[model samples]
Target chain A: MAHRWKNDLTRADATPYAAFMNRRQLMGGALGLGLIGAAGAARAAEELVPNSWEDITQYNNYYEFGTRKDDPARNAHTLTTSPWTVKIDGLVDNPGDYSMAQILDAMTIEERIYRFRCVEAWSMVIPWNGFELADLLTMAGVQDGAKYVAFETALRPDEMPGVSYPVLDWPYVEGLRLDEAMHPLTMMATGIYGKTIPNQNGAPMRLVVPWKYGFKSIKSIVRITLTEDEPPTSWNKANAREYGFYSNVNPEVDHPRWSQASERLVGGGLFARRQPTLMFNGYADEVASLYEGMDLSKFI
Target chain B: MSIADRINPLARKLPTWVVYVLYLLPVPVLLYMAQTGGLGREPVKALEHELGEIAIQLLIIGLCISPLRRFAGVNLLKFRRAFGILAFVYVVLHLLVWAVLDVQTLERVWADIVKRPYITVGMGAFVLMLPLIATSNNRAVRWLGPLWRQVHLLTYPVVLLAAVHFIWVRKGFQIEPILYLAVIGGLLALRLIPKRARVAA
Candidate 1:
């Protein structure tokens, strides 16, 4: 009755949820079916890095899901994830379309415990479920001219009420330097907390930029363009002072209007003392290499 | 006391029943949450925030009562006292949650206020609510006598403090808090204009 996956399960923290589903399947006599039937938590958890998916996605700065803390969770239930596809184009050799099913089939997902830092000054430890971007880029065959990789999420105003805001440029945009994109720590996340991606948290596909602020991670992606240019991202374009393209997690590069030194966990209650934000979000060992010899102060 | 013994029957009974009923609203909300097994995983904090926001919204409505009577012609009068008390209730609950669960000590609480500007503003706003709460009852109102008018003026300061609390509470000036401030500010300003000046001489 035990799940094939366990805590030794990897970054996406598929252990607990998968264990639950395996037990459920064993009891239902559908154990050998080998496919999920409402074992959603398992799929999301296993597929994503553990805790990588917000215990509540509403806390995410993706106002594209709606502004309130609980709005994204409440409203994101309407998305249809099965029909999803991500188009890989531009400087890539495999400049074509790929379905969600195909993308999953092509790569093995790993769980990475990433300390998520928001520009607003909050932090979370999330085990994300996704493979190295280098592996995916390797499949796509990045061209020599490719300096950055751009990501785009689907823009449907009907379901995503936040997209109606003039505050942002419709579809969410994010980019990574070629080296950052190719780093082992960078991932194309599809699920979290051992389940398929939640509709609100950018299901099917999203990117996890560990050392950067949460917004830099980008969610609900539809297109990935390997380009020679440094892409103008949505947040940076909206407020240059608040959101920089590098968006590194550094206490020194304080958010223009607020201090970056400490953060409070939303839903962590008013009483939870704001904790000092760790430099590089505690991922300095893994990700600090990407920015070697570069001054984070100037870049940030 | 019998209805015949009441000095001002309508004044005495209507406000009393209204206050009692008003005080009862938050109970159902709290109960349903309790029945739902305490607002889920991070129940205390989430519930505290929800209750606090609802309370603030109610205060805004209460502040709107006179404007409602003048402009909308709604008999929202009976609800004003209730609104004020409920807003105070939520504010108190908001503080209690922080003081007990979050801070755990007065020293730590004071330190938090000093260390963080938002916390300082938030606690200061809560302190402002104390006098307004004490003066809400007829006994204290009668005891203070003419000073009652001046003491109740704390409402004006409380409103400003609440706005300031919310402004600094946000990482950046958020739209919702700003909207609340503008609306609330406009209403309070409307109260200061001389009423007779508007009428023809």
Candidate 2:
């Protein structure tokens, strides 16, 4: 059966490609419009200016490429995404090396414009083209005992320089509760801005859990396992104190090193003021029920 | 004339106000970058990082003055005060950029300072430098006598803390921050050698 969930967010929320490039022009227009409706229109205008392909592709924190923000863009182009294959194993019935083309054929794709919040307290609004993770999970036939869904990225040491430095355990891993994995909002992105996903932005395939901090949406995935036990994530395993098992974007539950109360919006240009971070990255109404009564601060 | 000798006479002729103007030059360039969308995606973060880097560079340059005078016979002691003042200015600006623009809340700023180890060390370094910056004048140098020298010894520890702060703030084993720590360590090592051994060498 096809996934029946309807995305409430529409194309209207997405910034046009030309408008994103000409943001200064848009800002000037917004300023003129700001006078008509006062502060509210100006604030709304600020939200519409999306990150450029250059910004999205360049300023990424893919530790697999390297630790520096620019390293991914500099190094990821060498990644051989064309012949990629995903190994679906563990509690699933259908388990094998599914080619990228095969995976794309298995599900229906759609575009989603989402506010992406990173654990480092930076954010961007991206228009991603992908299908729900549940659709693919269902296609694979998730077994009854599976309580969690674990994902892994490719560990090509020669191609990925940062892997050599032990920045993270090679073949970076991430997981979600079975329920969270099955949620309609959980996505497997293949492209951005209506183009094939850039190498630095996780080429071929990647996860996009909008409510969680961006790291939770692991990049360049090659293996996905349906497990009965909770899987060890990369950052959480590296430093448990700094990164929690559930890396939800919560303003109240601050990261040990920095405040999560606010995030600097990317592409806002110089002097861009920080915007207050929302609970579950403003998807509390949709995703909050998944956690229920659990203490987020402790989990965080 | 050699580069040092050539620069010395011009440096002597220039007014003290030149130091202030030279350091302040980066401010407008950064502002222009911000306005023209040259700071890439996160402009505020870029500005804050640039300011912090400048502060650290200035502090390192200030530490180098003594070694240059000793080894190279270039006495730039007159501009030493200017370097310290400008470094302090950049430090204050970096902190303000983080507090006002990045964090955007007084409560959050205090929370970060208290909870974050990097912030704690960075703030501690700033506090240690406060008395040194305050006493960097002719009046304080003459009035306090040898007590002023004792108080100014805080510079060594303050610089160490600042270097440690830079290391702690990085995400991974980045070489840049480690390089900074090595530079500071080398400067401190130079200071440790006996004056008699140094002169003989």
Candidate 3:
């Protein structure tokens, strides 16, 4: 717990459910800690909220459900998260489809309050319950040659509408350098706020890499493939010029479409000033060393 | 009777200031929505987008007036000034919102205008419309005579640039923006038809 960075945002930062939903009649501010999946350990400044469960669950960029932000909340309920299985293959000594329950049973879970920065430049602070990704890689027995970790999200066309759009080649894929994958801060989140993650927010299991843009944290993952070579990521494949594989939150490196210098905080109210974006989304102190000599602008 | 004959009397019955207020109603509505948190998650961004879209839509509608009269026999001339002025005002407000609220950094706003192609094109459209906005009054129209009409013709290029700005600012293949471009292109194409051919048809 001492090593884990804590967010200072308390329950006060969260918008009440009624206000968040834009209901005309304001409701009493009831702190719904029901969503906190595990016992809370960190004390956070009231700078970031878990974005009110309604905001977290309702507004999402799960393209699997649809392209519009609200599409997932409306469409993802049909997804069967229970009885889910993840195929761990490639450079791991143990290669098989392990049930979600089996994987959770084998790991220790902790609550982590992390800033969720999107490549689109909006951000959120989420309280996630999960175990470090390193633990899972360790359990699977990473082979000596593995240099990168590739991940694939579920590709259920019958369930996920956006797959129909050629937004990207489907069975959405992402990867992290082996070192990045094994970073202590990188976790496989199972729940948010203190409850089982809602369907739209990638229920059952998802990846949370705070230092990188939100896209790098692939959601509703069904496959984890360790490899010796760099793996193709979804966005980088969609547009190489805009989305780089690393996708680290660097204010200096602008997205070709928009500036990465500042981000509008989700739930920050209409007139809330956009805060300056931090280098590596303020995790530069921890993760900057990982890309010590790499030319980020070129790589990006 | 022609639409111009019938509607001209009805339009004349309405006072100019009342028409102006009616034309400019969306400003207060947008401001109210912004204050009340009705603009959704990112309200400023939403407001900026809505205002910009409204400005472009009005610009397109303003461009459509002549073509509508020429091809369809619908005379909306009396309202064109209202449309153009409201569009210009909205564009100014949209730019201000981006600068004062969205960007909040003078240096960044300047950089965005200079460096970004979409912003550059958008700013170009606004600057092109400035003279048109300035000379919108009756006195300027009377003084400039035919030369005023020639300067107002800048609307064509401004529409094209604004439409291109709208298209360029979006990410990926968005159908709505392409549809907007198609509408603008259709209006511009209608203007290209010979006057006698349009009348005969």
Q: Lowest summed-lDDT stretch of 10 residues in model 3 chain A?
A: A36-45
List each candidate's DockQ score: 0.21, 0.52, 0.35
Clashes of 1: 25
Tens digits of per-residue lDDT for model 3 on A1-300?
123444444454666777656521221122133322121111121244467676577668888888667789889998989899999999998999999989988987777878889888898878888888999999999999999999999999888877787667888899999999998889999989878888888877999999999989999999999999999998888788888899899888888767898787788776665666778877776789999899999887
Q: Cα-based RMSD of the predictions, in order?
A: 9.9, 4.8, 7.4
Give candidate 2's error at residue A258 in angstroms. Answer: 1.4
**Leading candidate by DockQ:** 2
For candidate 1, lDDT tens digit of each residue in B1-201? 643345334544565456657666775777477345455434455566666677677678878877765544455566566778888877877777766764455765676677666667667767877888878887987899999878767777677777776765553325777887898899998887676865544
TM-score of chain B of 1: 0.76
For all predicted structures, in order, the TM-scores are 0.72, 0.86, 0.85
| Model with the higher lDDT, candidate 2 or 3 | 2
Error in Å for residue B21 of model 3: 3.3
In terms of docking quality, how is candidate 3 classified?
Answer: acceptable
lDDT of 1 by residue, A1-300 (tens): 112123324543455877868765563554245332333223323332333234555455557767665677878877677788889999988888888888788888765555677776666666567777787888889999999999998888877877665657777788999999887678878767666767777787888887888888888888999999999898888777667899998876666555676565544542454555667875666678788899988788
Over A1-300, each residue of candidate 2 has an lDDT whose tens digit, in order, gives: 334444454467566778767865665576566442333233433543457887788889998888867789889998999999999999999988899999998788887777899999999888888999999999899999999999999999888888888667778999999999999889999999999999899989999999999999999999999999999998898889989889999988888778787777787665565667878887777899999899998888
* lDDT, residue A186, model 2: 93
